[model samples]
Target chain A: EAGVTQSPTHLIKTRGQQATLRCSPISGHTSVYWYQQALGLGLQFLLWYDEGEERNRGNFPPRFSGRQFPNYSSELNVNALELEDSALYLCASSLAAGQGKPLHFGNGTRLTVT
Target chain B: GESVGLHLPTLSVQEGDNSIINCAYSNSASDYFIWYKQESGKGPQFIIDIRSNMDKRQGQRVTVLLNKTVKHLSLQIAATQPGDSAVYFCADYLTGFQKLVFGTGTRLLVSP
Candidate 1:
């Protein structure tokens, strides 16, 4: 079984621009989660998509949004990106949301907002 | 305004020694807790997890202890190795919610 996979291992965007990151969950996983890991900070939950619907989101602003596709892949979009948005964007997959199962994470897309 | 935080910014231990990282959570209602290991430039990896109903849970060489009374959590790594040098984060699942609250994380350094 392949693990979670993320696109654009590294990305660079200017301030006020938009950044889009992608993720592909494990073969049989149905839930995809997005997290932001800023430098010197912990992983902050961004969004959770299950069954093609967003089940939950974190305290982040509306600028941070994402969607899950029919195939269980996910895309995280950051609009009006700020310098603080430079961080590692992680994607994880679980059997389902809140099922108390361990999440498998991808290497993450390192976004650098200039 | 609610969150989880680490008591220490960093921890240094000798190889073959045991290491313990501590975390404090503000949400008393959090029922599920997880410990994750994140390597440099990589994503966070699941180390282990424990539920509110259990006080202690053990993995191969890792152990998680949860103290619901004080809303404290700890991860103990036995015989720490060089590969264990990374950041450890403790995440708490809100009661009846799927969102996970994560801590600031602690950097573990195992010196040979």
Candidate 2:
């Protein structure tokens, strides 16, 4: 089966602009998650969507928002992007929000804010 | 604060040797732990995971040991190869938290 896939492998946007990243989970997966990986840092959880509803989110600002589509795909939107917003955005999927399930991640979208 | 963190920023080992990466978490409620391997310009891939109920779990050439007493976890890779060189991260998750908290990550360097 195909793994999680992300689009626009590389994205460059100026400050104050908005950036959108897309992700498709593996088949039969229902939970989609977003994470931001900054240089020299670990992955920071951004958002979580399960069953088409926003279930949980990290400490990121409201400018960092996303939604899960009916098909279980997810879109992460970063509005008013700042220079610090530049990072690799990763998408992952799991069988469900249940405990003990490992997440399968995609290659990620490299978002560069200039 | 709920956070997972690595003890080492980098580790260098020779090929065919064993590699060990360590991590710790602050949240005692975290019952599940996972280790991930990420290559350059790529997202993290699942390597191995061990629940709080297990002291050790093995997969392929990798072993994950979890110690709830110290809130510590370790990933041991046997016969390390150059291909095993990458940034390895440990993550923790609570049963109802619905999200996994990741550590700072440790870069593993293997020399042939």
Worst 10 residues of 2 chain B by lDDT: B1-10
Off by over 4 Å in 1: B1-8
Q: How large a fraction of the reference contact set does each model reproduce? A: 0.57, 0.67
Instruction: Give the clash total for candidate 1.
Output: 0
User: DockQ: which candidate is best?
Assistant: 2
lDDT of 2 by residue, B49-94 (tens): 9888899999999999999999999999999999999989899996
Runs of candidate 2 exceeding 4 Å displacement: B1-8
Q: Each candidate's chain A: what TM-score?
A: 0.97, 0.98
- lDDT against true structure, model 2: 0.91
Measured by TM-score, how close is model 1 to the native structure?
0.93
> What's model 2's lDDT at B83?
99
Error of 2 at B88 (Å): 0.5
Clashing residue pairs for model 1 = none
- For candidate 2, list the clashing residue pairs, or say none: none
